[model samples]
Target: MAAASQRKPATLQFFLSAFVVLWLIAAAFPFIWTLWGSFKVELDFFSISDWTNAITGERTQTTHGSPFTDAGYYGAWIQEEFWRNVLNTTLVCIFVVATSLTIGTLGGYALSRSGYKYVFWLLIIALIFRAMPPITLVSGYLPVFFDWNVWGFLPTAIIVLVAINQPFTLWMLHSFFEGIPKELDESAKVDGCTQFQAFRQVIIPVMWPGVVTTGLFSFLLAYNDFAVTSMVLAEQNRTMVPAIAAFLGTTYTEGNVMFAVAAVVSATAPLFILVMFFQRQIVSGLTAGAVKG
Candidate 1:
């Protein structure tokens, strides 16, 4: 009986492990396929005659004299000057993340510690603004931008992105602040630390994980933003997402689809690396409120 029971559990465990493996493969297959195809010519990657050409790279080998080629990357990065868009994106994300975190940390800490009734109302107002679609917000800003002649600039997009992303950061950091015990503040005070000093020294050190989590989220918002960047920035000031869209071509313009494919891979690779590097902090930040500290 004991032997039979052990065999049943072993079989179940094997099946569960297999299921998980299959699920991971299924989830990862599209990205893996895209990554592979990024190195091949469009003919092989999007072959209608033989789907196997994608895997075999037959057409790619014929064209490039090798199974893999850097033509797509070169075309996108060098020929199309996608690097400029990437630089623009980097600037937007940096400014957005820095500005959002600075304001969010201070505002969140204040709201979390304040014993006033208006704090609730303030958060509610922020939530309302956050819930609105970004496009709608952009439309309202457009006329003003045109009047001010600030319509198509990196700073304009950064300002809008900061506005759009601020509420979520405030809410997230506020929750993180709430999770921290009040005793820390009191202890700091006992040690002759002023409120600002306590916040800068004692609270912020403990709040580091939550801050990182919020900053990463803010970075993603600014990084991936298309609607606002597309509308607010001029052709030369376009960011990566809008530039990738341009590579897709519209009715009036011819696009290099392969260039877009390569750009997609380039843009996505960094996100995976960032998440992996900060995985621990993300987890801690998310779970900070679950058990009071």
Candidate 2:
């Protein structure tokens, strides 16, 4: 009986292991394929003749002598000035994350401490705003932006992204603040610390994990946004994602599809690095409020 039971469990474990392996391959294959193809020429990468040409770099070998070439990267980064877009994206992310966290921390702390019934309704309204698509806001801003002549600038895009990120930031930070003990702030107040002082000294240090996680999301929003950035930004002031889109439009027709592919791989590298380093903080922040005492 014991032997039979063990056999069934072992069989189940084997199937589960196989399923996990397949799932990981499915998830990782696209990035692996893109990275591989980025090193090859368009003909071999696209490979209409034989799919193995994509793997073997057969046509790429003919053109470049070696199987791999950095021509795509050279075209995008050096010839096309893709680094300007990278700088724009970095600046936007910094401004948006900083601005969002500043406003969100204050507002969330206030909401968590206040016992008013309106606070509940305010949170509900925030949820509603968060649910709305960002594109919907563009129409409303177009007239104002055009009239003000600030439509395609970095500051304009940064403000819009910060506004979009605020609702979610408020909600997340409020929950994190709530998880922290009220006594910490109260004790500081009792010792003659002003509300702001208590918040700065007592609460702020403890909230870093949650703040870091929320800031990561804010950074991602500004970094990855294509629709709003594309619509608001002009040709000279475009961010990386929109620049990549523009590359796709012109490069494919110019027989430079690999430039777009290279741009994509370049764009993805920072995010991968961000996740690798801060993954622990992300998990900690997510679970900070799960089982509050």
lDDT of 1 by residue, 166-270 (tens): 888988898889889988987998999999988988898898878888998899899989899989999999999999887787411554577888999999998
Residue 91 lDDT (model 1):
95
lDDT tens per residue, model 2, 2-72 = 68656566788899899999999998899999999999999988989999998999998999999999998
List the global CA lDDT of all models. Answer: 0.89, 0.91
Cα misplacement distance, residue 231 of candidate 2 (Å)? 0.6
Best by lDDT: 2
Question: What does candidate 1 score on TM?
Answer: 0.90
Query: Would you list the clashing residue pairs of candidate 1?
Result: none
In model 1, where do residues sit more than 4 Å from their true spots? 1-15, 190-192, 250-255, 283-293
The parts of candidate 2 lying over 4 Å away from their true place are 1-8, 284-293
Q: After best superposition, candidate 2 residue 230: deviation in angstroms?
A: 0.8
